[model samples]
Target: MKKHVAWHIVRACLLPAVLFSSRALADCAQDFARDNAYKPHAGAHRMHERKLPLSLLDGQWVPTLKQEIINTISEVVPPNATRITSDGLFGPIGLVVIGDRGWIRANGDAAWEPLNAAESKEILDGAFTSYLSFNRMSDLSCTRAEHNGRPARVYHYKMPSELQIGSHSEITAYFDDQTGLPVHVEVEDGNPRQRAKSTVSIAFDSAIAIQPPETAGQTPRAGNADPSGRRKSLYKHPPGEAL
Candidate 1:
């Protein structure tokens, strides 16, 4: 896994005047060293919940677009590997991010498929790469605070149009004050009305390898999952690949 033992330059997103000082940077790094160090291991895990924009689901088949999401349902692990899963509209979907390669355990016990196609970039991006990008701290400004129970700090940032979640404009993250591990995240979709909102939390991390259920169901393969099987090879990223 990627470990930052020394101080690396922080690519500040703002002007020098608002730049973080050396001491501040050190503190930030120290507070988040464990988090920053964990480039992701073969056993690390991540669970998140992201709500898609209602507009995207405005088609004839999915007309109503009720609040459905590929919700994450696991804890974030450290050091070795990470496995992520979500509740898809049809059933449940999962990704096993091991050895820097994304192996997807599509519905059923069909076979472990590798994400290597260009079109599968969205899945690859949202599955694991984005999870790594989410940890890039130099671009964010953080303040110390206590959230829930852990000694925590909050980092704030503005998302570009492409990175925005649905109609959200801002992103806020809560990290473990001591370990620097992210505990909770909130994406503000609306302000005045507080209509559509998105939130994700890192419930916990375990000191073990991530694995799929022993009795994984035996659902038949979909008649058509990217007819070209493009999703099987969408990306070639190890845990250490650049964001």
Candidate 2:
């Protein structure tokens, strides 16, 4: 089994700025760092540390929002070593694996299946690597701002890799002006000529669980069947490559 880690970046841009109140903006920024920032398991190297204002955690909405984000992430990227990058609007734009050797990239219509897992990982790693590199080199900025009556923290980062040439990606976490919990996320990216935008709305007090699709009553393949009628892999890789 693959050990999956859930990672998602949400953004929004090019929209009217008059939507949010100043107070909301502050709250959202704090929540963004809190909900999204998490340390790797013990003994694991720490990548980044983001701190949240204590005031934001006092509201009941914080834990609610956190659970929603976690559930949403679990749906597309299983708990195995998975990395998901999206405009944070419509759906996932790309998914890479540390679980399997493959990946899936989206281009508006259907997703494109690459030739192999190595190719998929290469594209995902390249895109992110390029994004980080450009963010460091350019006038990239991230700030807490209000938009459309919601509090949000915006990220304006540059994309340097050839794969993302002429592209810009933005992420915004939307917090309710009255409550600190994030209600939605907006993400935008692509070239200046043509852009892809996505908005993801989160429902409070909702239960989102990640579970395997039901396959009840289905018989397992001859070679795949175990004594319990569950499907099993016919071949297993050596220990090191198992995941």
Best by TM-score: 1
Give RMSD to native, each candidate: 11.9, 17.8
TM-scores, all candidates, are 0.51, 0.32
| 1-243 per-residue lDDT for model 2 (tens digits) | 011211213111101122222333465333433443322221111111121111122232121121123212312222233334432212234444443354443411223343265544543343322111123222334566776756665544333322155554565444444544444555555432223344555443223232221332233233421122311231121112211
Candidate maximizing lDDT? 1
On the 0 to 100 scale, the lDDT of residue 82 in model 2 is 32
Task: Give the range of the ten consecutive residues with the poorest summed lDDT in model 1.
Answer: 1-10
Residue 114 lDDT in candidate 1: 59
| Cand. 2 TM to true fold | 0.32
lDDT of each: 0.44, 0.32
